[model samples]
Target chain A: MDVGELVDRAREGQPRAVARLISLVEDAHPRLREVAAALTPHTGRARVIGLTGPPGVGKSTSTSMLLSALRAEGKRVGVLAIDPSSPFSGGALLGDRIRMTEHATDPGVFIRSMATRGHLGGLSWATPQAVRVLDAAGFDVVLIETVGVGQSEVDVVKLADTTVVLLAPGLGDGIQAAKAGVLEIADVFVVNKADRDGAETVVRDLKQMIAYARREIRGESWRQPIVRTVAARGEGAQDLVKALSEHHDWLVSHGELERRRAERAADEVAAIALRELQARLTDLHGGGHLPAVAKKVVERELDPYAAADELLAALRAGRG
Target chain B: MDVGELVDRAREGQPRAVARLISLVEDAHPRLREVAAALTPHTGRARVIGLTGPPGVGKSTSTSMLLSALRAEGKRVGVLAIDPSSPFSGGALLGDRIRMTEHATDPGVFIRSMATRGHLGGLSWATPQAVRVLDAAGFDVVLIETVGVGQSEVDVVKLADTTVVLLAPGLGDGIQAAKAGVLEIADVFVVNKADRDGAETVVRDLKQMIAYARREIRGESWRQPIVRTVAARGEGAQDLVKALSEHHDWLVSHGELERRRAERAADEVAAIALRELQARLTDLHGGGHLPAVAKKVVERELDPYAAADELLAALRAGRG
Candidate 1:
């Protein structure tokens, strides 16, 4: 249970060790910091990609196909599949990983599924940490896939170096708008199940959406590419891969990749801080001090802002 | 901005005081306890109802019709329409409130729209306080409507004495199974947009679903009432109202109303504690200690569990 040893073993390319270490992190083990500290300086080598969309949208299928294509090209690929947790069970619904059985024997591929145990964002607690694990494990490409909640896929934007939103045909316009906002974050948009009706419509809609996204980041240009694919058949897998390579080329050409990585690093710092604060706040509540404060707040003797200020001042005074 | 003064003014029917006080509570204003304490004893008097489902399920239209019907009966009703913050304006999507414009002049019916501000679980930080305000304002019933996020709908379940999940027809079998587990919490089931195709299939599925929900709570003898409604046209609205009434009667008959209220109060206690903890935990990461810890974690010299434990222990020991 000593987190330091686990981090050491995980870094030595031990799969079980890596998995166990991540479990500790997910449960908010106090030593998570030590593990992150060990892993932090070693990252920035892997290209982390994020894929997210509605439940039935064939994300898993596309991910499987992408894995095959990447590995065929002799790339060491690691997939961080963010799965949903069962509220009653407090464990992940591992159903999504059923399709990932093909590469179990392949040492060149590493797949880790992290449960979003009702975390507010679609991604889970240990995702960035796990990404670091994959990065240190020397994986050239890391793809993090999220089972997105309705109309909110913004979380992936913050997590991925290149965000891909996998959209199916037949979503119509308003639902498309909800997805439209998600599209703005997409470096590559794929209309999967292209054989289905309205594939062209989705592609056209994505183009219009890309136009809108472009206006926001005006003149600093690398257009969000729309790629069509039938993932099940691997029909357009090559084209999708080509689009990814071209997008990477475009990012390097425009100097956006380095800038984005810098932003992402800054975000990591903030997210870690936020995560730490959240844990302390939870502990304070579990202890006796907060409920009384809350009761007083509930009773109208205190207010939340004043309570927070008091708590913060107390924490600041207390932190050595 | 003293919430105590505002709560008192609001109690005295001062509109500005009411608006200002609710905003304070919504923002988790520090003096909330004082305001809430003043209003606490006024609650548990109204049968707070919650209406929730995905967007485009006619929740607003249903809310308007029910408010009008309740008003016709000469009863005071309060509607808390919850909308997500608009991506463009960073404010409540005011368009959601546009559906209820017909009752703008009706003093007997008060409709307020609040932003969720990215709170998952169908529970907003301001939700309970808003309900308390309406209750203290002497409304006979308070209906809090939310754009339900899947799985996270349990948040609304914690607040409502009766949770009504409005579902449209033809969401498909996969979604139906997804709804199966959550539907057990429902007191009255609604098939909104009953005129749409596959209404019968949805109702039939619910019947089968109730059988499972019933088995889960075998000792608790309650039959969930399923009502079909075309909310936009007011069709089946009366039956829906009747069903709600009968459900209330059943609650009283089974002595569940008091039990549910006690449960809800317990939940409020837990929620406050959890929020308090989250705030404190987040404080540690913000204190410039996390980056160091993350580096340690990444380096494999420290494991996450031990690191988390050490960090938390340090805080606790410092407290000592």
Candidate 2:
């Protein structure tokens, strides 16, 4: 089938077609540009929500609960679970796969896992493309879920319209949430397992922290709301949804949504250009200016900074 | 004085001069090429070691003990502690500084903390330059310690001749160490706080894990050694040093040291060139091909991949 037909079928909510397009993106297939070109007209309609937190903070539970809530509202939801794919997970990863079984059979729910183990371009390159695929497939809401407190989670924040940072009591995650710089990114903070003894304290602490951040700021900005949730029991899922909707409303009203989407597109464009440049440099590793400069730097005839300049000059000069 | 004078004084072992040069690196000063050129001949002498693991694993304590052990051998040590600078760790960060006060007054020790906050270049960009500064300053050993298990820690692995992954008993760190992909990077595993009850179990688990890893391998490789240490009391500092020395020796014997250094230099060159290209793209964002392409992509007249290709083509065409 042609790229046009695939995109047409994907927009008709055909799961197989959507998955095929994403695989094309992931693999950087030769025809990826064609597929993306065909899908572009249908993109940028879905609301992208990012869910991130440290491990053992019940991120998955909260995500599952949120999915059910969205589905109940008659919204088609797509989930992209970003797994670090640790070889050490052994059997635990399988356990996580089982937790999502509730939504596995739902036609409205399209769930997929993207592993970071072997991707050279990294999560930043693949994620936005997959998000576009889901968005083009006509999903109303796309949930981007990532575990741990790391740089990749930070990248996810850029793609999301509303970011929910989940924390639990007794995990010391409140402080971690602050330390990992997650506090600055969260649009809504959810204290999952709110029935626990210290869950209230977690909520109080998050509010105070947000207050402190607000005081440090000069201009008008969204004040992140903290909500209490017992996600395992689905108690506060409604409140969580409400907060998300409010944030989304604020984003749209403030004209920030357009700015954020433009920034995301700019970043995507820059990353692809960078990767292409890197590939070109790698291709010139032997019998080229790159190796010559590298050899000089390695032999102490020139420093890396100087070598880099010489290499860049050569690359530019060759354009002649 | 000028950068040349700073280089001269830094090479003469002036602590302030060394500190200033590193600050220039961290700041990405415009004359960075000049400084790197001056320091090239003096680089490659220091024994670079990377210490990393999850938070609350007593990484700082272990680092202090290792410093003392290396100091006892009459070696000059320069430590570049990569602090995540989490706003939540206002108190704990101070505690870490206090822990290193024992060697603060020693002329043989130079400890500097590099905060990741507000630095757009990131740890990877600044770290190798700082290491070059320390290496040129006559330090016999340079210790690069970073907290948390993430992508930055993986970057730390590339800069080290030997990487020691520190873990503590009862922290569930053994499994975490595996999950974070630190298992593959470790040349030596130090189980800090060996006097604790679960210390023996941690050691046993690590050995069995390493054994399992070895069984799956088809080629000859360095077998990671696990050493137990009560770092707070400095009980096993001797053994830790022994393990590091043995790993260093193996790195030399197998010629992996040369390969690693070449790879590091190659990465540095690529990073600098990428930064240059990114700067050019940013310049083009306002009135050139980048913004033009971005607008078309945003409007769905062109896809991001196609737009990126156009931008690259424009860059290449301009080089002509």
- Model 1 Cα shift for residue B199 (angstroms): 4.2
Q: Residues A1-320, candidate 1: write the lDDT tens digits.
A: 76566667766767777677667656766666666666655667888888876556788889999999999999988888765432221122355578888987887888887765456323434577678778866788999886555323245445777888788886444235454456455678788999998888878866776777668654656667778899989878999899888888887788777766654543454445445655555565566555555555444455444455555555555465
Native contacts retained, all candidates in order: 0.04, 0.43
Q: Model 1, range B1-320, lDDT digits (tens) per residue?
A: 56566667766656566667667666776677677667775656777888876555677888888887788788888888765432212122355578799998887777777765555322535677778788787778889886554344346545887888777775544234345444655678788888888888878877887887677655566677788988788888788778888888888898788667654543454455446554544565566454455455434455444455556565566456
lDDT of 2 by residue, A1-320 (tens): 58898899999999999889888877878787787778888898999999887667787789899999999999999999887533333234445757998998898999888765546557777888899999999999999987754565467655788888878888753554454365666778888889999888887877777777778762467878888888889999999999999999998999988777877887788777777776667766654667677767767887998878887876666555
Each candidate's chain B TM-score?
0.87, 0.92
List A-chain TM-scores for all predictions.
0.86, 0.92
Candidate 1 all-Cα RMSD: 5.7
Candidate 1 is scored at a TM of 0.75
Query: Can you tell me the CAPRI class of model 1?
Result: incorrect
What is candidate 2's lDDT per residue for B48-156, written digit by digit as tens?
Answer: 9998876677888898999999999999999998865333333455567678888998999999988665454467778888999999999999999877545654575
